[model samples]
Every structure is written in structure tokens, then in C-alpha cells.
Target chain A: MNPISHSPLSIPQQAYSTELQHHLFGRQLLAAEIPFSLDVLETHIEQGYVAKTFGIELDHCIRCGNQDKQLFYTFPCAICRQLCTYCRSCIMMGRVSECTPLYTWTGPAYDFHVPKSVMNWSGTLSEGQQTASDRVKQVILHQEELLVWAVCGAGKTEVLFAGIEAGLLAGKRICIATPRTDVVLELAPRLKKAFPFIEVAALYGGSDDRHKLAPLTVATIHQLFRFKEAFDAMIIDEVDAFPYSMDPSLHYAVQKAKKQTAATIYLTATPSRQMKKQYRSGKLQAVTIPARYHRQPIPVPEMKWCGNWAKQFQQKKIPRPVQAWVNERLQSKTPILLFFPSIAVMETARPLFQNLPAVYAEHPSRKERVQALRDGELQGLLTTTILERGVTIERLEVAVIGAEHEVFTESALVQIAGRVGRSFAYPTGSITFFHYGKSKAMVEAIRHITSMNEEARKRGLLDG
Target chain B: MGFSMANCYICYEKMRKPITWTSLFLRQPKSRICSNCEAKFAWISGETCAICSRELDESFRREQLCLDCLRWENNPEWAGYLTKNVSLFHYNDFLKELIAKYKYRGDYALAEVLAPFMKECLQQLEYDLITVIPLSKDRLQERGFNQAQALLDILQINSTELLTRIHTEKQSKKSRQERINLPQIFRVTSRTAIQGKSVVIVDDIYTTGSTVRHAAKALKLAGAEKIETMTIAR
Candidate 1:
């Protein structure tokens, strides 16, 4: 028979050391996952090539920086044979127990040599976009923070090209993080096309580029937990999105993932209350792009009383006004997006709308269905709040079936309204909010859009 | 206890335990997993093999043993070492992922999710001593916990360490024939405690049954009166 197999570390020491260095640079990995023997790690630690910290210490997760005691749990560890505390907050990535050590390379860093001119994009930015783009570059050069409070369809991603190029040419690493995976999937390709020379690592939950050391990275906020002060410049897109706005651990991960002197740029269509308060108090450097790249005002949503739509849905009938609106869009051959409060309501009312394709957060073919609507292969699609942001369809007319539901917060409604009139080819479209009774959020959403339009008009940023 | 709220260990969803008169007067046990996640675990029921507790089809009903067990029984060297093996769940895809997350990824809290089922199964078995299949020192350092022992700890069952495993290549990479042909990997640690006592062996999964059989053989050779195996999946 064959002899016992050797561990992975049995490879020649030179090749193994280089491989370990490649994986450990700019990353805080568990000691068990280092792929080499602990003796080698200890030698590296003694030589000041690696820094090791307890994975979890005194109810704190050093890797993810989760300090909440409720998120920590204890279990009897077989290796230590003692009660070990683990962080449940970031357990989806990997379990960080008290006995485990997080390793980071303190040796020479990975060198990224970028081209002189990284940006290949030829499109011209609008007057509003140019202002925000200049401010972003200034923030990056000064190593400061700035909030770009741009309206939806204002080409926020395009505005970051110059800033990213500046960081790249200066021999700095940059990362663009969003709260959702959909945004990462949407942004990575466009950023790659713009900066064709720079390596862009698109990291989400099962991304292949998780271990790649790149000059530029586009990732979800959750993916930042594995990084340790890895970026010289960090851009947070969709700063007001879910989980990022509500979860404190994600905020901690963002801070822990960036260098202490790194520049930060927050991009959002609807900033959180605290962010807006900071802007109003002159504590935050901010710029507002109220006009779309097409130099057009945002389409304000019109509130229409649909008379107890939920009750009507229970009767297996669509509301009269909502039905009329769908027919109007269908007759005109305009693609439409109908937002429901929840998946159950959307599925229940789906049959009444001539078998329109419905999508939610958990829908298997959510991307394909949204792409079909964008390509005009599907006339209209029903969706939940998951499609409120990061989905753009040309000439798309939007309507919210149950706008007064608690799920339709003011920011959500504003995002839903922003879905209309996004494309420059068809920069004008209709948005309607069909509700049983007008809620405060519906009114605020309408006011929020109207004020942005007025702001663009006052500044002469709007063409019409 | 009044109405209480707890998050599931598996999915982290908030579970609301409704208050009733019995709950007010009695100390109700809290659920470790939410109903949605708990429903995914398929319990082993209906017809099963008498030897290894593998769910059997109707075609194998006549002999009451799976074909693999028949092969093991025919081998004189391996015959009658393990009395029987009882498993709680079928080795379905969900259980496969759960085991990977629990045992390989070091999510130690997941043992609590399987503790109730294991406790129920162990209550019906007649054994004077219970012990878990030992992991090699190298394997234990990598996984950070012995999955089988973790289940016993969550159930509050004190298990004895009767066997120590010799380091070998991972069993998952070996074929069926190779696994069966492998030599004894376990050495009895405490011969006196196992002498003349009925023993139970616990493991995470019963795939080829060779691992437990090896442990049973070591215990049987150590003068144990009887040996049986218990596992979370087969």
C-alpha cells in the first residue's frame, strides 16, 4: 500500500513561503486556514514578517471588530478543550473563536504598478457631474472625506472615474464598496471597462477574486470583514442601503478595512438622517448633483388613491386606478415596473396582471428577469423593494401598488420614483404612487423629488 | 416564562415562543433553530438497514440489510464487530452542508441544533458507557473541535474517551475498498473503564461504517462486553 500523505506544507520551503505571503498580504485570515505549518508561522512572527492577534478577545471579534456581547456565543472547543467564545456576527465568512488567531502579513506589501492614464472612458460628464467629480478628486488628494449627494441617474459611477484614476497613478490602492451584491455585479464590469489596465477584484459572497491582490476592488460591504487596512482610498456607494444603514457591525468593518489616513467618499441618492444632519451642520464636506446626466429634472411621483388595494388583492382583483395605469403603459408599449410591498402580495396580485414576471429578493432568476425587462423582451415586470435601486430600464414607467405599507419607507419610495426616466435616450417618463391612504412617506417622497427638481431649476442645471 | 424571543442558531431569524398557561407555570425548553430551518432536516424513518441504519428501498426489504452490510458480514475479519448503528437523519444535501459548516468550518454552536434529536435517540439505547470516535491530533487542530463530542456536550451527556486515533490520510479521500482494507487506526486509552461494559460509539456521519467498526474492534478487543454505534447521519 501507499505511505501516509504529507500535509500541504511539505512542499519545498521557498515555494510555500511565497504562496503564504501572497495569500496573507493585506488580509486577516484565521490561523487554521494559513495552509502552512504553525511552526513556519511562528518563525515568520518572530522575524517580524507576520502579525497575529486573537480572533476573539473578551467578547470582541478582532477580525470583524464586532463588540456586541449578544453576537458572541460559547462552545466547548476540542482543540483547546475549553469553553471557547465565537463571533456569530461574521460566522458566515468563517467562525472566529477565542482560541483562533488572525494572521496578517507585516512584511513588504504587494506592489501594484498601474498605467499613467488609467481611465479609458470617453464620455463627457454633465456640469453637475463634473463638479462632484472634481470634489471627489480633491478629497482623494487631501486624504479627507466627502459625501456626494447626487440624485439617481446622475451617473455617480462615472463621476468616480477621475478620483479612482488619481488614486491609481499615485501608487495607491482603491476600493469601491456597496451594501448589496447586485450593485457589485453591476459596477465591477463598468469599472473594469473604464480602467482597462488596473486589476479590479469584484468580491461578494462566493466571488473568485476573494484572494486576488488588486490595485482596485469592487466589493460588497460584508466582504470588507476579511480585509485589514487594505485600501488607501475607499468609496462607499449606496451609503443609505439596507444592512449598511441598520447594522452597526458593517460600519465597524468599513472603518477597520481602510487605512487610518485613507480618503473616503460616500455616494448616495438618499442619505441617512444622520448624514443629512451632518451636512446641514457643516460638519461634512458635501456636494449635491440634483440633475441627471441628461440635464433633466427627476420625475416627481403623483399620488393616486387606489382605495384599499390590499383588500382588493384579497378578492383576487386589481385596483381600478392601478389597472387603468397598467393598461395605459401597456397600450403605449412602455416598459413598466410595478413594486409591491412584499413578495406574497406581489405573487397574489400577479395573476390579475396577465402573468407578468414577478421578482423579489429570493427569486432565482432575478437578474435575468430584470435584464429581460431592460432589453424590452418583457413588457412589464412585477417586483418588490429589492428592485427599488440598482436596476435601470429605458423608458420605464414606475408605480407602487401599496405605497403606504411600512416597507415603503421615505427613502425606498424616493428610490422607487427615481427608477423612472433614468436613460438618456428616454429621459422623460411617468411615476405614480397608488396607495389606499396617503402616508407621510408618500408625501415626503413626492416632496423630496420636487425639491430636487426645483434645486436643479434654480441652479440652471436643468435644460428644461 | 412569559413570551420570549430568541434568534435561531442556524439562520439567525427571530423566533417568538408564544406564552401559554403551561409556559407560565412550567420551564419550557427553548428551541435552538427556527421552524423554517428545522424543517429542512429530513429524519430517517420507514424501512432501514438493520446493520448500518441506512434508509433502504423496498427491493432490499427481504434481507433487512443493505448490500454493503451484506458484503461486510461476509468478510470474516470484519463480521459482528459492531452490534448495530442508529442514525437520526438521512444523509441528504442539507445535512451534508450542515455537517460541513459544523465540523469543517468550526461553527461549534451548530451542535446545539442536533442535540435534541441525539438526546431522544440515546434515551432508548441501553448502554453503560458512551464514547465518541476520536480525531487525530492533526485533524483536531485543524477543525478545532471533535464534532461527535460536541454533540454529546450539547446534550449534557458525559462521554468517555476510550480510544485514541493514529494519524492517517483523510478518510473522505479513500475509496470503499481502500477504507475497508485500512488497518486498525484506534488504540484503546482506558482498558479498565471499558472492560466488561456495554459501550456506545458516536460519530458525525456513518458513510462506509469502517471508522466506527475500527473503533468497535478496538473496544471489543479491550474486553468490552458489547459495542454499538450512534451517529447523526448515515
Candidate 2:
């Protein structure tokens, strides 16, 4: 029944078999989702062209590597006619149950052809960016893990162009995974422009490139759950971002998505406490870029006591100091971003700011409002911590209206401060922390910025 | 089934079942979904068609039947096959997404999330036997479980496999005319079990009412006396 020698298979069957092979290569797919009939898949299995394993094996989901017993539940399966266990952790991708099998191509691997010249980026990297870029290339070539401890707005993405190009020249598959869909949407276009000759598949929740095979893939880390041992090199952008830093399943997914010896480059502005400890202990190799590409220091946040903002908000009044800060930015026509502790507080205080646009995680027009702020259509915007990272607005003044709130972690506050002074023409801006009371996170955030500035000055990475 | 910290099946948020004087003494049924996600479901209420339970506007409430049900009843070939259908929720966007995740995505736990609603509607119906609308062999294997049967299983209700279906393309892909005009797809299984008995057909959703009607016709021809249908959504 083997069709390798063109046995008696019909034309359509042959075409489907070839198409299945191409799609299943470097990807793990649910058996039910495979378009071809089981008979054809069985033939491929007999010919050693495909391998199938239980979707959930040994009480863990093979695709997403979820092992939590609480996340696994059983249902009476119609096909098996018995109780079958399934993983709820990755059920959003598609249910991976014990009775189901995950299909992966086991035949010859596809060779990705790369063009002679892959790097098409015209802009030059600064001194700090160039040094970090060379280190990334070295790490990829040696198949080692490297943590790029770059500050925000330090041209981290530019540093990866050289490493990605080198990996492509070596005919290796590379994947750039980030925690947020916003980062994937932002990076996909930039990567496509940088490597004009190669195909780049950007995968997210509802992305249309789910089945496309390309040499380079940029996707949300959740999308990496669908792949297994697929890439030769992996770059995790925003490594310390939410859901990725807190969720172990995502960490397991990243580990499962790459080859055993694959190089991993972790790019993060504020490393997690655990990551920081590991780097200091020499457990993980590292490179640090402390200065922005404009050869300027990060904007330090100034603490200003705006007394009892919550009580004032209950009375439908903006705190005196907070009101003064908004007036200054509005009068000077300086575009500003005011971060609130929560969406409820932001909405309550929104009408107080002349009904300026408020952007949060679930705001419907968040992208348009941010774009409007960038286009100078809006003088200022009120936001939550969702804009803490992955957003850069030049000459933008930022303030945390309730900096003492528990949501304002040290890393979050630093990232918020990093949103200012991003462009070369405007390398200095003011950041104010208008808090009712001081918290340990607020103090540490200030110290974090000051130390980074001092480190940059000591290394002469900043201009005199 | 037991009280513990459970994540919402839809949003994955940690659902805290509030404790109260009543909850302390009585065993409350744990919710599988959070309140926020639960609030999004539009419960079918107010005036609805007598036959298919499709929601009707105020102007159409006097008609007592929706236009689709009227068309079904006007045809002698299909009239009176399905005695009545009681649906629990409206087919809003949220319910559409919930059903898609449950049926197409193989999220079997959603059956538990939907069990209470289904049970509340089924309790008021009088029937000798409860049966799920059968799925074709290909579809059953692909989805791993029959959605209607899962609802019954979650409620600990015993349902007889009174009907078998022939393998065919998905009903959603067919147009309304194509669905109404298709050849008989269900065959009665074990005629003795359904003969001279009133049967209630359980299904995930009652869209166009063709699927339940076909099942009812097959059971009716095999000697069932009365045929009624219960669905989660209209």
C-alpha cells in the first residue's frame, strides 16, 4: 500500500498526500484537523514518512507540555467509547485529548534556501547596538543561550537583524516569539522589510498564516505551542512580559518548540528577579546595552506627592498637583501619557481630563488612539499599564497618577519611564510619579533608572 | 463537582464561588464559568414561537409561530413531525462562539458549563425516552464526542441510542433549501425501544430546525408516538 513508487494512487490522492507532508513538516497538528483521509495518513505512516503520538501522553499535553493535574479533565469520548482525558490549558488552540493523536512529519526534512544577501536594513546601529548585535550573531553560531539585557528604546530589534541574517545564511530556520500580539504585529512588518527576499510567517490567535511554511517565523509565544522542535534558533522578545513570565506552560512551549541544541536569545529590558539572579551567578551568558541608540540616558521619574487622589476622585476632583502637571503639559502642547493604576480609576478620572482618550488592554480603539497621539492629533492620553512596554513615543512626557498602587511594579515603572525621549531629536523628557503615598516599588523603580544611567556614564556609552 | 478553586472554562479566570448562609448549609452547584462570561449569554425569554421556540418581536408575538416554523408546518410532508422544541438561549454572538468552541474545538467540558441550562428546560418536558440527535460516523470520530450526548452525560441523564445517522457533509455548510430537501439521513435503531413511546431529542442548537425534524421523522416512522426536541440555543 506504499505510494512511494507511485503505486496505484489517484492523481488527487497524490496531490493531497504531498500537500499534507508539506504542511505537517515542522509542525504538530491534531489528527482530526488533517485534511487527508486516515487511509492516506496510514500509508504515509507505513512508509515512515509520518509519526503519530497521543495528543496527551503520561498525563501531560505533548503539544503544549501542560502537566498540571487540575488542568486535565476527562469526558466520555464517542470515538473511544470510554472516558478520555483532555488538557484544558491549551484547549483554546484545540482540545488535545488522550484518545487523539498529534501528527508530525518524520520523513526527510525540508531544506530552506536562503538568498546570498539577506540583510536589507539601511539604518545604522549605534555603538552599543553594534556590540550587542555581534554578540547575538556569535551566540547563534555557537548554539548557546544568551540573555540580551538591553534597556528599553536601546534598539534591541536592530541588534537581532545580523543574527537572523546569519542564521538564514546557514540554512537554519528561526522563530521570533513575543508574549503580546501587539509585538508580533509590530515586528512582522519590520522583519518582512528587513528580509525582502525571504518569506516571513507571522502567527497569532486569528492569523491567516497558520499553515504557511517559511524560513523565518514571527509569532506570539502562544502560537509556538503548535510547533515542535521546529526552529534552529529562537528569539523571545519581551521575555519578562506578562503571561510569559508568570506562565510556566509558555516556558515549556518555548523549550518544546526548538531543537535540543537550538540557540535561544532572550531580549528584555527589565529582566525578572530570577533571570537577574541567574545572569549574576553566571548561569546564563549575557550582553547588556544600557544606553539608548541616541547616546542618551533613560528619563528618570520624579516623585511628586499628590495627596489622597482616590478620595479626591470620589469627590469628582483631580488632585491639585496632578491637575497642575496636566495643565503644564497641555499648556506647553507637549504630548503626554498619564498611566492610571486600573481601568476603573482611569475611566472615573477620564472626564476630568477634558474627555481625553483613555487606552487600556481592552479599549476598542487603543491602536487608533495611540496612533493619534503619535500624529499630534491628541495632546495627551490617559492609559493603564498596558502601555508600559512595547510602545515608544518621541518627546512624550509620562506620569503615573497613582504610582503607589500595587500594580506599578519596579519593572513596569521603568518600562513606563522608557516610553519617553525615544527619538534622537528629542532625547530628554520629564516623567512624574504623582502618588498619594510612597511604596517600595516606587523607590526601587527610581533606583533602577539611576543605576542604569550611572552604568551608562561609567562605560562612556552616553555623550558628554 | 466538588467545591474548590476552579478556573472559568471560557475566560480561564479564577472563579470564586461566594459563600453565604444559604451556600454554607446547602450544596450549591459549582459554576464552570465566571460571572462575567456568564452574563454575556442572552437567555431566551419573553414571547417565542409555540413550535420552535424562536424569539419573536412584539409585532410578531401575536402570530404564535415564527415564519420559519410556519413554513415547516405549512408543508404536509414535515408538519407535526416535531411536536415542540424548547430552547434555552438565543443564538447571539456570544452563544455562537461558545457553541463553536464546544462543538468544533472539542471543548467537552463546556457541556458541564451548559448542563444546568439544559437540565432546567428538560425537567419540564414529559417524555418516555430521551435521545440525542445522532452524528454521522465521520463527524463523531472527528469531534471525539457527540455534543448533545455530552450534555446528557454531564447531567447524569440516561439517554437511549434510538437513532443512527448516515455519514454526510456538515449541516452548517448547506443552505436552508438544501437542508430541508436533503434525503433522509437518520435511521431508527432498535425499534422496540422507541415504539409506542414519546421521545425527547436533545441537540446543541436548533438552527433552521431541519436536523431535529429529520430525526423526529425517522423515530416517528419507527413507531414513536410523540416527538419533542430540546436545544441549548435557538
**Which candidate number has the best lDDT?**
2
| Model 1 spans with C-alpha error above 4 angstroms | A1-23, A33-36, A107-111, B59-63, B74-77, B190-196, B221-225
A1-464: candidate 1 lDDT, tens digit per residue? 23575544444433336677788877888765578878888867766778898888765788777887657888777767888898888886778888788999888777776878888898898899999999999898778999999999898998999988888999888999999998999889999999998789999998899888899999999988888889889999999999899888889889988999999999999998899999999999899999988888888888899998888998999999999999998999999999999988988899898948999888899989999888889999999999988888889999998899999998999998888888878888898889988899898888888899998999889994
Model 2 segments more than 4 A misplaced: A1-21, A33-35, B1-4, B19-25, B59-62, B190-192
Please report, as a residue range, the 10-residue window in candidate 1 chain A with the lowest summed lDDT: A7-16
Model 2 Cα lDDT, one tens digit per residue, A73-109? 8988877888999998888778888878888888778
Q: TM-score for all predictions?
A: 0.91, 0.93
Per-residue C-alpha lDDT of model 1 across residues B24-126, encoded as one tens digit per residue: 7786676788898989999988888998888888765448889888888889998888889999888898899988888877787888788788887899999
- Per-candidate iRMS values, in order, are 1.6, 1.2
Residue A343 accuracy (lDDT) in model 1: 87
lDDT of 2 by residue, B35-63 (tens): 89999988888878998888787655457
Candidate 1: residue A255 lDDT (0-100)? 94
Q: Ignoring the other chain, what TM-score does chain B have in each prediction? A: 0.94, 0.94
- DockQ of each two-chain model: 0.54, 0.67
Candidate RMSDs in order:
4.4, 3.2
Could you tell me the lDDT of residue A428 within candidate 1? 84
Q: List the residue pairs that clash in candidate 2.
A: none
